[model samples]
Target: MSRSKTDKPSALVATRPDPFRAAFQQTVELLIQRRADLLSETAINAYVDCDWLTWRGGSLKLTTTGENICAQLRNKARLHARA
Candidate 1:
């Protein structure tokens, strides 16, 4: 028997690990840590473009999405450390 599209896994789901996951995580960590010197202009631009971050009074600020990402990353880090 064949399954319908809804019954099967969504095509949007990734079958393999994202190669850039670690780099992206590190970038997010740097953003959360407010490590300006560690961040590239391209990375900052990408974050701004994605609405993950914003500029306020010449300083970068985290949007709600960025806050959530930081929280999730921190939680994962804590969990990994415990493991």
Candidate 2:
């Protein structure tokens, strides 16, 4: 019922971000940047599953949600770079 002195405060125990997810998002960002070499059948399917991409005229296209996500990623990158 009481907090232990050995226990770390939640604020001090920051969770590290997942590198794989970050890498995947960077891949998606590349796709948005028209890096055709990065988009494969499996990658397309994965993006589609997340509703961040769609098939349009037999070509992969970003959905509205995808655009928003890409924008957020770009902003975050910019902020991180500034920092």
Candidate 3:
């Protein structure tokens, strides 16, 4: 069996441990902690570009994808804390 380029995941697709994802996750964590003001413009742009966040009334709002990612991050943190 053979796989075509379209059949395989694109190299550009982000996976776990991706820097961009990590940065975005960190931003989300800060926001969840009520420290969104600490996020840089780059991080905000990355999240928006990735569709994990959207602008609402001049403020960044988490999309479903952002919420899921934040949930995953929280779970991982809890696991590490338990260990």
Best by lDDT: 3
Residue 29's C-alpha lDDT in candidate 2? 64
Error of 3 at 30 (Å): 4.7
Candidate 3 lDDT trough over 10 residues, lowest sum: 7-16
* Candidate 1 vs candidate 2, lDDT winner: 1
Worst 10 residues of 2 by lDDT: 8-17
lDDT of 1 by residue, 5-43 (tens): 644322222231343333557776675687867888987
What TM-score, to 2 decimals, does candidate 1 have? Answer: 0.56
Number of colliding residue pairs in each model:
0, 0, 0
Residue 39's lDDT within candidate 1 is 82
Residue 83 error for model 3, in Å?
Answer: 1.8
TM-score, structure 3 vs. true: 0.61
Q: Against the hidden reference, what TM-scores do the models get?
A: 0.56, 0.58, 0.61
lDDT, candidate 3, 5-57, per-residue tens: 54433322354355666677778668778787998887677677656888998
Worst 10 residues of 1 by lDDT: 8-17
Candidate-wise lDDT, in order: 0.64, 0.62, 0.71
Could you tell which candidate, 1 or 3, scores higher by lDDT?
A: 3
Best-to-worst order by TM-score is 3, 2, 1
